[model samples]
Target: MKHVVFLSAISLLCTLLVSADTVTNPPHVVQFTIDPATTHQQIDNFSASDGWSMQFIGKWPQHKQEQMADWLFSTENNTKGQPKGIGLSLWRFNIGAGSSEQGDASQIGSVWTRSECFLSADGTYDWTKQAGQRHFMQLAKKRGVDQFLGFILSAPVHWTQNGLATNTGRGATFNLKAQHYHDFARFMADVVEGIERTEGIRFNYISPFNEPDGHWNWVGPKQEGTAATNAEIARTVRLTGQEFARRNIDTRILVTESFDYNCMYRTHPYVRADRGYQIQSFFTRDSSLTYIGDVPNVPRLMAAHSYWTNTPLTDLKKIRQEMGEVLRAHRVRFWQTEVCIMNNDTEIGGGGGFDRSMKTALYVARIMHHDLVYANASAWQWWRSVATGDYKDGLILATPDETLVDGQFTDSKLMWTIGNFSRFIRPGAMRIHVTGRNNDPESATNQEGLMVSAYRNTDNSIVVVVINYSTDEQKIRMNLHRPRITFQPYLTDDVKGNDLKPIRTVQSGSVTSIPPRSVITFVAAQ
Candidate 1:
C-alpha cells in the first residue's frame, strides 16, 4: 500500500499543546509512514575527522586523551541507560603533508594547523612522526570504531612544485610537481602499509585530494591544501590506485573530494577548466582526459564537501537534488565526506561564535537530513571532531589557544544532535522510505518544522529522527509496520541541557509530541 495521511476530527480539541517552553495552541499533526520494504542506500558510516588537532590533543595526558575519546567514540551506556558517547562508526585520520616538520619556515603561520609528514626529505619513511595522531587511531580501534580512512589535504612538501605544503604562486595550478606523482602515490601507500604492519590498523579508504576543484584559493596562512584540475585528480588517483595494487594494500581510493556539491554536478564559471563537474567528468565514458572509472583500486563512489552550498533552505535541497541525479545516472554512490559551518549562517549571527545553543544544532541537522535523503550521501563526516577555538567547527570545542593543554572542554549542542543519529543508526543500516509529509513524498523536509527521516537496521529495528525546528510543539503519528510497537525518544534540546537524554517510552498508534527547537530520535527495536 502507498503512504497515507491521517488527521483526527478531535485534533482541534487536542489543541492545548505543551511545547518545550510553555503551553501553546493545539499543535498540528503530521502523519509519517515509514516503509522498510522500500529502501535506498546502505549507510557506510557516520564519521568525523581528527584533522591536525589530534596531533596535539592525542599527546595530552593518557587519561585526558581517553576522556575525550570516550566522549567521541564510546558506545557504552550509563546506569541511567543514556548513551555514554556518540559512538562514531568511522574515524578519519589526516595524512599530513610535511608542513609541521619545517616549523615556522614552512610559511604556514599557525603551528597547530601544520601537520607532520611521515615521508622525510631524504625519501625515507618515519612511521613515528605523527605520534599524537597514531595515539588516537589506536584508541579508536580499542573503542570499537568500525572503519578507518586516511585523507590528505596536500602532497608532502618535498614533492610539491614550490617545495611548500600550502600553495604555489601559480594560481589555480596544482601544487604537486608532475615529476613526483609516482613518489607521492608510493609514499601514501607506504604510510598505509607501514601502519598496518606496525600498528595493526589498515585504512579502509584513502582520499587523494581535498577540494581539488579550487573552490577557494589554496594559498592561505591557515593550513595545508592543494588545488587540482580534473586531469590532475584523475592522474593522481590512478597513480595512487596503482601504488596500492603494487603494495597489495586492500584500501579503496576515495575520489574527487570536491569543495561543494555543485562542483560535483556543474562546472562553476569561476573554477578552472576541467576542474568541476566531477561526477560526470570522471565517471561517464566520454570524459576522455579524466575518466578513471575503471581504475584498479577505485570504488564506484564519489565524495564532496558541504561548504558554501547551504543557505536560503530551498536552494540547499535543489543543489543536492541536481548532484543526486547525476550520481544516480552514473550508478555511483555518494559520500558527504566533509562539512563545517563556513557559511553566513544568519540564523545564529554567522558561524563566528562557539555555539552551545540548540539553534546551531538544528541548523546542522537540517543540512545532514538533506544530504542523506536528498543527495543520498552514504557517509556523513564532520570536518573537525575536536578543536581548540571559539569557532563553530569542532563538535568537541575547547578554549582558544594553540598549545593549551587543558583549560575547559565542552560538548556543543551539535554533538548531542549528531548523537541522535550516529548513536542509534549504526553502520550497515539502510535508509528506508519515509512519506506522508503534506502528502508530497518527494520532499523529505517540513520546511520549518519536523524534518523526519527513518532508517532500518539489519536486526529489523527502526530509528526515526525528527528535527523539530519550529518554535511551537509539533505532533507526529508514526504508521509503523506492527501495531503497539514501543519506542524511546532521546532528545537534544536546551531544556535537556544539550545531552541526549531519553524520555518516556511510547507505543505506535499514539500521537507523540516533539518539543520545539530540538532533535528527537525514536528507536523501535525488534
Candidate 2:
C-alpha cells in the first residue's frame, strides 16, 4: 500500500509539470549584476546617431513651429538637461535631393514630405530653407553637443545621368564617371561651404555615400546608386578630401558606408545575399588603387554599416575577430557607424506589441555588444532618430494623428534601451572590457532567445542589460570573479516596463531574477 501511494504522487507531479507548460504564462528568471573592477571599456557618452526625424521638429502645426523650435532649441526650455547635457552627443544631417517636390515619384512612399533645402529652385545653397535644421543644430550645439556629421543620399537631379535621382536605363544603377567624380566632389564641397557660409556650422565628418552598393531602389523609395566598387569609394574620398583642402573646409570624408564588413572587404562574391555585386577586391592590399590618392587614408574614417550579416552575439564576435585581423594588417580606423532594426529574424510579428517588441530592444543591445565588445568601434550610428513607419525600424515611433503636434510621438522601449547607454554613458568615454559572455547556457540549446549587452560608464559605473525573448521569465547568474564589491541594479522589463517617472531598482550581489519577455538594465555604480 505504501509503494502504491508513492507511485500515485509521482504520477500527479508529472501531470502538473506538463500542465504548467500549457498555461497562459510560464515561469522565468531574468537578472543581471555588475563588476566595475573587471571593466575593459569606458563609455564616452550615449549617442542617438540618427538624423532630424525628430519628434516635434517638423510635425507641429505651422503656427506652433516657432514655439516648438524655441522649446527644442532653447537651453532654458530643456527641462531634462538630457537633450542638452549628457544627452545626444552626435548628430547626422540627411541632405535630401528635393524629393518631396517630386510628389508621388519621390519613391519614399507617402510616409514623409521631403524637407526643403536651404537653397531652393536656384540650385544655390539657401540656409533659410533649412531653418528647422539650423534651429536644431544651434540647439544641439548649445546643449554641449559639438560633434556633427552629414550624409547625402543622392546628388542633385541635374547632376545625375538619368536626369532623375533614381537609377538609369538597362536597370543597372549609374556610377559617376571618373571625370564626374570631381563634379560630385565639388557638389559635396559646395554643400559644406553653404552650411558654413550660410548656416555658420562646420561638419567634422561627411559620409558622401550611403549604402553605396545597396541594390534597393525607389523614387521616394529605397535607392540603388550606380553601384561604385571599393576602389571608386577610395578615389572619391581622395578627391573629396582634396576639394575640402582646396576650399579650406576642414570637414573630413568618411568613406564606404558599406552594408557590412564582409561585404565591404571580404573576398567572396555575394550571390544570394541582399547585395549581389563584388566590391571587396578593392579594399585588398593587392588592389591597383592601394594608395588612396598620393596620401594614405585621405578619408579619415573607414565606415561600415552593421547590417544583416551578424545577428547573434557569438557570430558578431567571430566576425569581429576576423575584422580585427584584416583591419590591423591594413592599419585603418574602423567605425560601425550605421545600423537599424530592419534586419532581424522576425521582420514583423502577428502580435500587436511585436512592432515595438523586446525583439527590437534586444537587437539594438546585441548589435551594440558586437560593435563594442568585439569590434571596438570608435563610433556607432543608429539609422534614424525617430521614424514614421514600422518597416524602417525607427528608434522613436510617431503616432498616426497628424493633428497631434506633428501627430504624436511615442518613446519606444528601444529608445529607452538606447537611453540606457546614451543617457548615462557620455561621448568621449572609452569602452571598458567586461568579463562575461552575452549568451546564456541555453542560448545555444534554444537557438533563438535571450540576448545581453553590457557597458562600463566613464565614472566607473557598470551597466549590464539583459533581454528576455522567451515566452516565460528568465533567471540569470553572473559571477564577477571579484573578491568583493558593492553594487546596484536598474531594470526595465514587462512587469516594470520602461517607466520614465521612476525606473525600478534592485540590490546587487547574489542571484538576480528578471521578468518574462522583458529587458533589464543592471548598473553597478562605483
Candidate 3:
C-alpha cells in the first residue's frame, strides 16, 4: 500500500502523538519544536563550534602511513554523510617545548608525547623537529579550516630559574624568576613568529598555559608539567603580547585555560591565598591582576577547560548565566578551550574503546548544547583530536601500523553525530532561540535523558535537534502558534530498518515518535 499527501495544506495539524507511557508516571513526552520568526527565548548568541586536532601523528607506524591521514585528509566519502575531514572549523596545533630533545625519563614514551613546556640548558628552540605538527597545519590549511589555534603545555626549562618546567613551590613560585618574564615571553613570541617564517602560515591565537588551577606531580623524571597562578598567567600574557607587538607579529592570545569555570570565577588557593586578586578581577581596572591594563581590550579570550564541572545541566546553566553577565559587562568573549576524560566512566565509551562510543557522542552533543546555548562560548576544542588508545574517546583511531581499527575508521557513529552539527551549522552562524518544556533542557537530558539544541542557518532555514536520553521509546509532538510553512524532520536513531537508518527525514508537521536514546535533527526548510 502507498499513501501520498500534498506538500501544501491549508492547516497542518498533527494529533495523538504516542509517547512513552510509564505505569507509575507515564513519561510525558515533552513537546519541543520551534517558531524561528517570533520566539524570543534566544539565550546566548554563540553556540561554540566543535572539532578535533592532533599533536602526535608521527608516533604512528610507517606502514600505516596516511592511515589516520587518509581519514582526516583523504577525499573519499566513507559511511558517514560528509567527507573524511570536511566538518571541522578549527585545528589546534599542540606545540612542543623540546621535551623530545631530552633522553631518559624526560622523554615521554608510548602514544602521547608529553613533554615539558620549554627547552633547557642549551637554549635550543628549533622549528625543524616539529615536522608532525607542521604537516597537520598544512593539511588543515588544505582542508580550508577557518582558524588555527595553538596551545602549549609549558615554557622551556632554560628560561626558568628553578631548573624545573612548572611553577610549583612555596608561595606560587615558578622556574622563571621575577626578572626573567621578558625572556620567557620573547621565547613564546619567537616560536609563533618562527612557525610563520618557516611554515608560511600565521597562527591566529595562542594559549600559553593549560589548566593552571590543578596541582600535579611531574617530578622525578616521570612527567613534565608546572603549576602557574592566575596573577602569573596575566603577567605572562602582558609581556608576551608586548613582545609580539614589538616584532610586529599579529598572533593573538587567549588567557588562562583554567580547569573549569570555578577556577575562573571562584576564589581559590592561587587566587585568594597565594595571590590577593580574584581571577575575574583581572578584567577590571581596579584589581591587582589588572597589571595587563584593560584585559577586555586584549586579543586574549577568557578560556577554561570543561572538566569535573560540566556534568549537571542545571548547575551548568546557572554558571553560564552568571558568566554571561560578567562577560557582557567586560565585553570579552569566552571559550571552552581544553577538556578530556582522564577519569573512568565520565566519558562515554572512554573506559577502553580506542574509538568514540555512543555514550561519548551523546555526552559531547549535550556538552556542546550547553556551551553554546548557556555559556555562549565562542569556540570548543576537544582535549585531543586523535589518540591510538583502546579508549573510545577519540573522533577517529589509527594504529601505529596505519591500519584502520577493526571497525570503519572513517565513518564511526561518533563522527556522524559530530558531523550532524559541525557540517550543517558552520562557523560565524549566529545562534537563534528555540524553547522547550524542560527547565534546563541541556541538564534534563544528557546520556541519560533528553537534550535539544536549535540554530538558524544563513539561508533562513531553522534546525532543531532533539536527543532522547532514556532507554525507552519516546513520542514527541511539536506545536506551532502562527504556522507558516511546513517542517521537515530527520531522525537518527538505533533503529534497524532503512526507514529508521541513521537519518530518517520526514516532511510532515504531525506528531512523530522517536526511538530510545536517539538523536534527531529537524530542519524546517521553508
Indicate which candidate wins on lDDT.
Answer: 1
List TM-score per model, in order: 0.93, 0.74, 0.78
Best candidate, TM-score: 1
- Per-residue lDDT of candidate 1, residues 325-363 (tens digit): 889988899999888887566766777877878888888
Ranking the candidates on TM-score from highest down gives: 1, 3, 2
lDDT rank, highest first?
1, 3, 2
Among all windows of ten consecutive residues in candidate 2, which has the lowest summed lDDT? 14-23
Candidate 3, residue 7: lDDT: 24
RMSD of each: 5.0, 11.1, 7.1
By lDDT, the better pick of 1 and 2 is 1
Stronger candidate by TM-score (2 vs 3)? 3
What are the per-residue Cα lDDT tens digits for candidate 2 across 341-374? 5435443332134245456665566566566656
- Give the per-residue lDDT digits (tens) of candidate 3, residues 85-139: 3246676776665455554434445324454333445666556665656766676
Q: Which stretches of candidate 1 lie over 4 Å from their true place?
A: 1-25, 218-221, 400-403, 437-439, 481-483, 496-498
